[model samples]
Every structure is written in structure tokens, then in C-alpha cells.
Target: MKEGRRVYGAEDDDPPGPQPGHEYVELVGGALDGQLLDVTSWAGEDREGGAMLITENGLHGPGGRADYEPRPGTPDKWDWQGDYP
Candidate 1:
């Protein structure tokens, strides 16, 4: 729930919601496949973010997109190629 924390699944316990200047990643699958969301809020069952389409190139969102590769030895860290939007 703290800002900049990476959450793997919905079943996992929600952390503190995102704070100002904080970015949160939610790995969504099953019903929402190939999608990673920027967690804006996690109040109860409500979850929201600026939707990003996960592609071979990278995570694409409105207004901006970046090429990201999974960091070695760190599943939570992504190597962002280009400026992070």
C-alpha cells in the first residue's frame, strides 16, 4: 500500500495507498491479462491506475510509454529503457 511498492496479485494484502509522487505497480492477470496498472487507490476491493499495456517493447500508457526489461535477480525491479513517464 505504500508508494512505489510492487504488488503481484489481487489476493495479496493491500498496502497503504499510493502517496503523492509515489508510483505503484499491480500485476494483473487471469481476467485482466497482459496488463500492469499504476495503483492509484486500493480501498477495499476498489483498485485503479493509469492502465498500461504490457508488450514486448514495454509498458505503454497514455501520453507516454517506456521500454522496460525485468531486472536480473530482482523480479520487482524493471530496467526502464528511456525516460520513465
Candidate 2:
């Protein structure tokens, strides 16, 4: 039998893996519910503002991006704002 294709963010552009001082942040909702985000470069308000990460729409190609913002009172995690073109 043949293996099936991944129709998710499994092959998306992830952070440079885990590193010192660069802890991982949880990604809630959307296509990246259990994904982690690296906001090491985001400083102060920038971290609070949010981000629009590019994600090749799995199987669809040029699939747009995955929006995420820091959860209220939860700085260690980001909530998915939704996907966009």
C-alpha cells in the first residue's frame, strides 16, 4: 500500500526548532491548533500586536497564511485569528 499525502501544516515553515532563550509558544485554533510559534524577534508591543505567518495552503498551494496573536493574559501562547489569502 502507498502512504497518504499530508493535507495539513505538517510541512509548513516552522521556526528554527528549539533553541536557548527561544522557547516555543503554543498555537491554538485554525490549521495550526497544536503548532508552536517562535516569537523570539518580536519585542514588547510587537509581540502583543500579532503576526501573519505564511503557510502554503496544504495541497492547495499558495494557501495563504495563518494569523496568530498572543492570548489575553497568556503570553506563552498564541491564539489563531484565522487563515487568509
Q: RMSD for each model, in Å, please? A: 12.4, 7.5
| TM-score attained by model 2 | 0.67
Lowest-sum lDDT 10-residue window in model 1: 44-53
Candidate 2 lDDT by residue in tens digits, 1-85 = 0123222333456433354575457777876666666566667888888777777652224757888888999877789887887
Report the number of the highest-lDDT candidate.
Answer: 2
* Clash number by candidate, in order: 2, 1
Query: What would the per-residue lDDT of candidate 1 be over residues 20-76, giving only the tens digit for each residue?
Result: 554454333322333344444444233321233333333334444444444455433
Global Cα lDDT for candidate 1: 0.39
Regions of candidate 1 where Cα sits further than 4 Å from its true position: 1-62, 83-85
